[model samples]
Target: MLEDFERGRVSAFFRRVADSIPVSDRPASLVITHLLAERPKFLEGVARLSDVAAVLPKPRSIDEGALRQVKAAMQVDELNRDRFADPEQATAYVESRAAGRSLGLLDVGGYFAPALEHLHTHFSGRILGVVEDTENGHQRYEELDKLHVPVFSVARSPLKDPEDYLVGQSVVFSTEALVRSRDDILNGRPACVIGYGKIGRSVAAMLHAKHVGVTVYDTDHVRRVQAMSQGFRTAATLSEALAGAGFVVCATGNFALREDDFARVANGAYIASVTSSDDELELSALNSMYARTPTEPHVVRYSRTGHYFYILADGNAVNFIHGASVGPFILLVQAEILAALALLASGQYGPGMWEVPAEVRQSIAATWLTYFHGVS
Candidate 1:
């Protein structure tokens, strides 16, 4: 049921990365966690690999049809995060599947990073390294006091630049679609983007392109300077950014908007997130402080002090509500992730954070350019 273009790209990626490693050094078993809704073809490709022990579906977003298709094609176990009441239970479930195996992890959004200490404590040297897919996850690994295994990140890789740009386009596309459905337009609205990372930069640029008065706020002074240099307005503080913003997009992939910051949002404004709710906004605090009303599907109104604001997708990533499809280009990042796992399986790296090797990045980029754009 997959498209030929997607299937071909994924196969070519696997073959290219597989050719670089001796068969003996490849991972014997793996546990992967990812957003099942975004790229089913890639997920299915990975699941069909020889040694996938289990698949953990990120509870936030999933496509049942894709999940079923992948399950029918393989005999591997499926673990749903929503099934567990606690992280420990999930970790225990993973441990159960990993019994008597040397396990590798392909993680997205740092789902398994917190459990690394526990996994390392129990599995010890039997655990291979982790391949993280997002900058949010990479930050989680960086915050750890000790890393039990090497973490190869494609988050900041040059290869991911295309995906990040597309992600920004998707965010704006979804936001405008939602707004248009309500008979509103983003043009001429005062917009604030609360992050200056790669995705944030793209979002700001897209908003500017749409004629929205976009102002950027970044915790990093360097990024703020960059934003100003790029001709977008800069806000030194969160309150200043939200002062009169009619549209707010949190792309920080961290807790960028907290309860205290809510009061500053302009009344009737639409607030959306680019990452998970927990990473971009303090949902728990907002739920407790404001009176929440379901304005419609994927839209909630939070009101207090006679002022109210709309939260898209109940504060979840707005783009996913509209399928968040960035198309076949995402395979580039997936290829880099596969290469990272291969490197980790080789036992050449020790416990610490590592970048996807230069050779791997170069190889993936070359393949992507040749296959997608007819570039040499």
Candidate 2:
């Protein structure tokens, strides 16, 4: 991109941040921003970081034992409890990503309202919503489950308010339950978990083991039972659980990181969206406010054979971001991106499995290089 800039192949970076236009297309100037982000795709096409990608071929999946060792090595407990506990960093991140439009989370699960709320307020007023995601998530909405589960999209009643029906959306990935449940058993600030489904349960158990305090508010009886059986106190009300949380972790399928929810939280609680969607993360308030505007353009690569994870916006999803994701998560995301990039670069970015450029693999590797910068 620098070369492109020097050769004038790309336009200068630009984007209208005013609230009037919510979803703006990526202008040519976006090329400059992507270059500045040095995202994998941008770096591959630019300075040719092919070796870095090659250096990181496909990674193998790991078992539970391997995961525990890595987590211990990373000192996740200390980080979660002391340094990175508050949503301030997460809010800052959202503010930068959202840039001025005020973030709006469509929370399918309202487990982490406190964290989400903090984001909206931190962004100077974004509107977020708590869209229930389970039959038990809301009293009035559980009946929607009877609607035919179309082979395609989830059933939607055009004539109904989600609060009036029970088809609560489900979120796929969330580490909140795990982290918060772990935090629940211990003594410190609480971490909120949004979704209480399968992954949510697993997260809760992980949290219990970690000895972290948790306060859950799910409509799912099974979830409540499971948590109670595990000795974790459950919250009967959303408002109660969100009273003074400092971190928000959402796993609900529908967007749980609503901007409006930010109102309930203090100025510091962190909001980490574990759901899968650029919609939740692509346009965050943090990004809009603090994201460097096409300043020193350079690719930011991150790869470490060991733990010390380089989370992408505090892991918007377990697959693309978390280090302890199921299987070789990073490799999976990298491989898919690589194959797609190869197709796109070759003008064959169609809907079939493809190969990733060696350079892209190498670019990911460079992200892991440890630099002391005179401190050492």
Runs in model 1 with CA error above 4 Å?
26-38, 44-50, 75-91
| Model 2, residue 149: C-alpha shift (Å) | 12
Please give, for residues 207-317, the per-residue lDDT of candidate 1 as tens digits. 998888998999999999999999999998899999989999999998888878888899999998998887889878876678999876777889988899999987888
lDDT of 2: 0.34
lDDT of model 2 at residue 286?
35
Q: In model 2, where is the ten-residue run with the lowest total lDDT?
A: 27-36
Error of 2 at 203 (Å): 1.4
lDDT for each residue of candidate 2 in 1-376, tens digit (9 for 90 to 100): 2344422211111111011122222110001110011223222331121112011111221234433433342211111111112567645544443455422221122222334335435555332222222222232233233311111111121212221111111111333333333332123657566666545555555555556676665666777777677676777755666667655455555545444444454333444554433324333543432332221111111222231111224434443332322321222232222222223323223222123444543433333121111121
Question: What are the clashing pairs of model 1?
Answer: none
